[model samples]
Each structure stands twice: as structure tokens, then as C-alpha cells.
Target: MARFSYRGRNAQGQEVSGDMEAGSADLVASQLGSQQIIPLSITETETLGARSFKFDQLFAPRKVELDELIIFSRQMYSLTKAGVPIIRAMRGLQGSARSPLLADILGKVGDELESGMSLAGALQQHPKVFGAMFINMIHVGENTGRLDKAFLQLSDYLNMERETRKRIKQATRYPMLVMIAMAVALGVVNFLVIPSFSAVFAKLGADLPWPTLVLIATSNFFVNYWWAILVVLTMGAVTVWQYVQTDEGALKWDRIRLRLPLIGPIFERIALGRFARTFAMMVSAGVPMIQVLGIVSRTVGNRHIGAGIEQMRNGVERGESLLRTAANTQMFSPLVLQMLAVGEETGAIDDLFEEVADFYDQEVDYDLRRLADAIEPILIVALGVMVLILALGVFLPVWELGSVVRS
Candidate 1:
């Protein structure tokens, strides 16, 4: 018998993990099923050493995007729904994959399945492309004999996520464009326009107005130290990028983002929407409460919320209801709590969570509509002020000089 490592929730909902001697990983999972335990993952010990290798760091292939996943899921669901075998579906997908990297990954997945590795096990080897959430859901689908439905649910989830992201991008696009325009305008004035005005003022030999003096000094700085400015900005951006890649730094940064004004609530709604929707999907898919919570707590994309969900999972493991545990966390709104309470009572938690997700969707939609109104005015006013400054700083002296020349 081969040794396998497994983690799962026991019949009493307690978290349990240990090494078990079984003929295969599938057999280990079957053993757990016999004990009424929900297996999260079961990996044979022989491959465990190689699984931990940092493939992501070493390979650095083209990263997978949400749109790509959405397309993949949709196609996979259609094929599966049409009764295509998993291997044939994957091979067909490999042939049609838009990205060469994705095609290669699909080919690898098919090869692994050919060699008798479970879908989850094969996908686990490509962590950069597929996350734990994707793997766990596939495992659940495989176990429950609902692989088609699983692909359909994943497709829906990914599509919703993609739409939400598009909305956010739409909401911010105007502001981003405004800032870029302002930057370009400022650069033109600093290097080109201001220098011309400064030369004319110097030729006039007049004592400059304070604004003009300030503008000339700024132009001089841009002219003399532009390289230094560029270097500093580049270095600062790289530093922040690297720092945000670390665990603690990312957690802190995520927390900071949630507290930011005007945008924080948007992200919070996004996180809640994701949680409610994924939770509903998993519940509806017949995944157990413990397994659903375990998978979702890590996939919500917000560290603070994920941590709270994890705490709730542990609470449930200790014989606490999800609602009571959620109440203690104080992360959810009262309306959501009420809905969840009703769901808990009615044994329709999935339906209630779907409603909750819809509510957040409406909230996000409203906020996105309001975001343009909120940010555009501020950006416009800032742009106006900058223009007013440049007019006063550069034109006043030119006006005086022109008046003198005309006279």
C-alpha cells in the first residue's frame, strides 16, 4: 500500500488530517467517504516532495487571466454537458486554447490524467494557473458525479467576477484618463512652455510676480533633475510592487485599501459579493458546510475577510452555527445576518446567500454609477486649478510684456 496525506472534516465537523496507507489517493478518499468525512485533498506521499517545488517561481509562464478562465470554463461546461469524456474535452480544449501557455497546460493535464493522476492532482501541479479553489471544486465534482454542473457553476462564477472587474475598470477609467492628461499637460508646460515664458521674462529684465517666480523655479527643477525624478519614481514603484508580493505586506496593504475613502466600500461590496455567490454555489453543489467554508475562506481575495471566514470555519468545527460565528466576527451587515439567520432556520441557506449576492451586486452597481460623479468632479476641479496656476504663473508676465511692447 502507498502512503497518502489527507485533510478533511470528520462526521462531527472537526478538522482532521493524517497519513493513511492506501492503494491509491482515490482509495484514501473513498476510505474517508466511508467514515462520512469530507476529504479536502488526498495526495500520495511519493509525489509530495516534487509538489512543493516552486514551479511558479521557476517557470514564470504567461499568467492566466480571469477572462481566459471564464472562456475555458464555459467551453469545458458546454463540452461536458454534451457528454464528452473529461480527457477528450481537455484534449479538444488544448487544440483550441488561444494562449500557447494555456494550451501547453491543458496538454499537460491530459497527459497526467492518462497516467492516472486525478484532475485535482494534475491541476495542483500548475498552481500558477489553477488555484486551490479550482482544484477543490473539481475534487468535489469528481466525487459527487456532477462534473458538468461543477463546470457550469464555475463558469457562472467566473463570468460574474469578470463583469464586476469590468465595472470597476469602467468606473475608474475617466479618473485615470484625467490624471494621465494632467500629467502630460504638466510635462509639456514644465519642459517646453515654461522655459519659453521664462526666457522672455528674463529678456524683459523685470522683477517677476510670485507665481511666475514659482513657475520658473519649478521649470528649472524639471529641466535639471528630471532624470533624478524618474529614477525615484521608478524605484518607489518597484519597491512597493515587491513588498506587496509578500504575505504580511499584502495583508497590511489590503487592510489599508479597505479603509480608503470612496473606494473602500466598493472593494468591501466586491468581497462580500464574491463570498455570498461562491458560498451559494458550493452549497447548491452539495458540498458539505465544512468543505465549502474551507474552500471559500481562501478564495475571497481579501485577507481580513478570508481570515474571519477561517475563524468561522474553526468555530463551526467546535459545534458553533455559521451564523453565530459570523456574528462574532462583526464583518457582515445586519441585513445579511438576518437573511443568513432565516436561511439557517429554513434550511435554504444557498437561496438566501444568492439573494445576499444579488443585494451586493445592486450595491456595487449603484456605487459604480456614483463613482464617476464623485471622482470626476474632484479630478476636473484639480485640473482647473492647475490650469489656473499655469495661466497666472506663465501668462501674467507675458501679458505685461505684451502691453509694454504694444504701447
Candidate 2:
């Protein structure tokens, strides 16, 4: 949809102007009319020039952080529960918001609210900050008059996500630090230490072993063509980054991420857990089955897994039972499948989905606890091999020289 700037007079004869996304100027006018505003003009907002980079944005935070979203949800829940008017609550939040971006967004949302847009509709304007699932839940809540409950659910879900992310980062930090140290060591040896040893060995004029020859050759290449190597590495990184930004590449990369060694299972469990939690929440909130599937599919985080959920939605639309459709996806473990079956039979799918989420969370926790232990041995072996190679390459030459001098 294109964004249009509109000017109008509201019910109290107050003049207002704001930007809104819609298909056409007529649609924008129609929306304003619904809000009891007589539209003076609606014009499509001009797009920014492609080459016009905003330097200030480099240091400014444009995107809302997860922590900010969680706080917003929590505060909104409290305010709504206290029966505060939605517009006043939004204005209060906007004034008190720590993030300038979030405050600006809330201000726009408040304006939209004053213009008679639903809460969900106003929030939908910022897709980057509020995801499809979030907007849908609010939409459902508005329809069902349970907006407070929706915010409560969102806060819970965001907290769970935040906890999972923290655990993953904690578990992987050691391995990441070790790998970085190894890389730095490798660079230092090649660029500084090995060159000195190579010069000494060249002066000795003794027959060098293959290990020393390999080390000298590697060091020489690093010393000679470092710029070329750096350029190649930079280009490769840039290429990969660009590729992953594309739809096909992102899908492929996400699939590959699920199969990565040592951490693949962790990624899978996290994605599946997110899906289960969202599914359970939507179902318990009385969202339609079809709509729940659609929302959960997009919000699952892994594109490959999301495609599977999309297929399940299609199968259900084709008149297949939820159990049958889910089984056909082949994404769930037998235990989860069994739970789903029982839930389907007992008409308690939401409760069963909750159980599934808990099961995955437990599995994720257990795997995370073991993740450090599992990766440590591999890192140790790698460090050992590097040390052994350097030892053999350097010491063997010294041993030969000593023998010759003694003889």
C-alpha cells in the first residue's frame, strides 16, 4: 500500500493532518470520513530519493527493541485494566516513553485513534514494531472486548522469547570467545611470529621439514597478499549478507540453520516452541482455527517451518482435520503428535498446545545446559591441534640445529 498525506477537519471543527497508508487517495478520504472528518485533500506521500542517506539515523535508534515492546505491553495491560481511556493511555505512554522512536510511533497511533481508527488498525501502521500476530491478537481482543487480556498474553510471550534468547546467548558466549581467540592467535603467528622464525631458518641453510615449509609458505602469503585476502573476505561477507536479505536466500539459510551441527536442535526447538506458544495463545483467545494457523505460520521465525504451517493451513482449508493436517507436515516429533491427537480427540487443543510449548521449553533448557559442555571438548581439541602444529613446526628445526652443532 502507498502512504498518503491527508488534511481534514474533525468532528469538533479542529483541523488535522497526518500520513496514512492506503491503496489510493479515495480510500484515505473514505477512512477520514468514517472518523467524522471532512477531507480537504489527500495526496500520496513522496518517496525518499534512493541515494539520499540520512546521516543522523546512523546514531539514532529507528527500530523499537524487544525490551521496549515488552514494557509497552505490560504498561498497556495495566492502564487498560484500570479502565483508562485508550486515547489518554496512548498519550500518557507517548509522553513517558524512553525510546524516541516508540514515543513518535505512539503519538501517531494516538492521532489515528482520535481519527476513529481501531487500536489494531493504528498499530498495524507500524509493521516493523508490531508483528502480524501482535496486531491480530489486538484485533481479536477488540472484537471480543478483552484488550487487557491480549496485552497480558503479549507480555508473557515476549518475556518467554527474551528469556530464551538470553539463555542461547549465554550458552554460546564461551565458544564464540574461544573461536575469536583462536583466529587472533592464528593471525599473530602468521604475521609476526612465523616470519621471524622463517628468516632464522633461511639463514641457517639447513634442510627444513615439510611442517616448517608449510608454515613459512603460509606466513609469506599472509605477509605479501594480506590486502587481497582482506578484500576477498569482505566481498564474500557482503555477498552473503545481500543474499540472505532476499526471499529465496532467507528461506534456504533458515533451513540450513536448523541443520547446523551442535546447535541445530536448539534452533529447531526454539522455533517450534514459539509456534506452539503462539498457537496456544490464539486458540485460547477464541481466534478462528484458520486465522490462527495463518498468523502462527508467519510469526514462527523460521521460514521453512512457517512453510510447513502454511501447508497445514491449506490442508485444513481443504477440509482436513487439524490432526491429519499437522501429521502430514512431518515437523512434529511422535510425542508432540500424540499430544496433538489427544487434544483433538478431547477438544482441548489449546491446552495441549500449551503442553507442547512447555515440553519444547524443557527440551531447550536441557540442551542449552549441555551445549557448553558439548562445544568445549571440540574447542579444546581444536586449540590443542593448533598448538601441536606450531610446536612441531618450530621445535623440530631447533632440535635438528642443536644436533648438528653438537656433532
TM-score per prediction, in order, is: 0.82, 0.92
Task: List model 2 lDDT by residue over 1-407, tens digit each.
Answer: 67788887878888777788776788778877765678898888754343357788789896999999999999999999999999999999999999999999999999988876678878977888999999999998898999999999999999999999999999999999999999999999999999999888778777788898899899999899999999999999999999999999999999999999989989999999999999999999999999999999999999999999999999999999988888898899999999999999999999999999999999999999999999999999999999999998999998878776787
lDDT of 2 at 275: 96
lDDT score of residue 270 within candidate 1? 93
Error of 1 at 305 (Å): 2.0
Per-residue error for 392 in candidate 1, Å, reads 1.7
Model 2 lDDT vs. the true structure? 0.92
Task: Give the top-scoring candidate (lDDT).
Answer: 2
Report lDDT (Cα) of residue 342, candidate 1.
Answer: 99
lDDT at 278, model 1: 91
Residue pairs with backbone overlap in model 2: none
lDDT minimum window of 10 residues, candidate 2: 45-54
